[model samples]
Target: MKAAPAAQQELLRLQALDTRLAQLAHRLNALPQTAPLAELATRDDAVRRSRAEAVGVLEDAKTELGRIESDVRIVEARIARDGERLTQTSSLKDVQALEGELVSLKRRLSDLEDQELVVMEKVEGAEGAVAAIDDERAAIAVAQQSLEAERDEASAGIATEREQTDRDRAVVAATIPADLLAFYEQRRVRGGGVGAALLRQRTCGGCTITLTGSDLEAVRRAAPDDVVQCPECDRILVRTDESGI
Candidate 1:
């Protein structure tokens, strides 16, 4: 598992790139528009419900108004027939009965007209409620579109950065030995994305643990080409003059 000092240094560069790439991915996922987009989704649901309720109300009002109008037509037709009969009637008793019926029919008409007016008012109000809900939904839709555009724009920029970082990683990884690179990848997955660390000042950079007498002695005695592992974190120890033996 030995690699040249230069190759080990390349691993450090790779680690830096990996860290930056991870950060970029995190930033892409946690864009500022994400929260607002979520909020917009919730608001859209509420607006849809309100619009449905308003439509129901409007339909009911229209049906009621239609029924009232139908009743008014029937009553008006009856009144016209009775008025004609009154003019043609001959017997005094028949004429008196006809007049009485006419008076009752007119009162009925007045009551029906009043009910119709009330229903018409309800229809108007219901229509207005529906329109208001529609307007609110439209505004929300516009806002959502704007937020989505912003999110996409931010994502595009991050995507470009990630592309460049990935290219750099590929180039750096290519320079390392195949077996070493594969081993590094394995360790990186198991060790939280870090496979190699500098043994700086006798401390394992991976775990920040300073090697003691026996462990430190072993590392100091190891050949320059020997791959040293951090006893604390099990990561490859990249030795340098700054390692302080």
Candidate 2:
């Protein structure tokens, strides 16, 4: 004997629910761990900060180096002028003072050159730090790409499954009587998309409310193919083999 349209509609709703549940479960299972993405983001931020710091250091060192080099050049020029003045000076005191000034300028130039060397070394160290940070960022990018690919693959499978389920739903819906479909849709809108439910153990599957003995007897007396609604939630109730009642 063919089941009533109400029972068929309930079966469709169950299938739809199961499909939705399965899709959700698949997505939940496929999701990446939050910790790994968070950790990667942290590393990326740190690398960016380090690179910025390195650039600042390098710029400062270069500026200092330039300043020191300029000072050295100025001292050398002053020494040359003093040397020419000493050779031309006939006065004894002026010659001695000029010689002292030249010696001081030479010593200052040497100190400036040493400072420039120190600045250059710091600049090199800063550049190396920048390079290291860049490499780390590159590695992080590769890992991110791999993770994205995995997520896409997992999502694709779920999409395919959902498409197949939708096709099956369409097929099942086409066989349903229009009047029954309209009734189911109306009830479903009010009952959270569950218009019909199975009768399990004398309880309403829609509300899980147990039926009284009299109500149970009444349901039992109904035609086998008749569509009946639950007294509580008004959802069409279908009897199944698993119905404890």
The prediction achieving the highest lDDT against the true structure is 1
Cα RMSD to the true fold for all candidates: 3.3, 5.4
* TM-score, prediction 2: 0.64
10 residues in a row with least lDDT, candidate 2: 1-10
TM-score of each: 0.78, 0.64
Candidates in order have lDDT scores of: 0.89, 0.77
Q: Give the distance in Å from residue 68's predicted Cα in candidate 1 to where it truly belongs.
A: 2.3
| Per-residue lDDT of candidate 1, residues 122-213 (tens digit) | 99999999999999989999999999999999899999999999999999999998877887888788889888888899998899999998
Cα deviation in Å at residue 16, candidate 2? 1.9
Per-residue lDDT of 3-95 in model 2, one digit per residue for the tens?
Answer: 574556456565465447566666756477444666788989988998898889888888888888888888888999999999999999999
In model 1, which regions exceed 4 Å deviation? 1-7, 81-105, 177-179, 221-228
Give the Cα error of residue 4 in candidate 2, in Å: 9.5
Which candidate leads in TM-score? 1
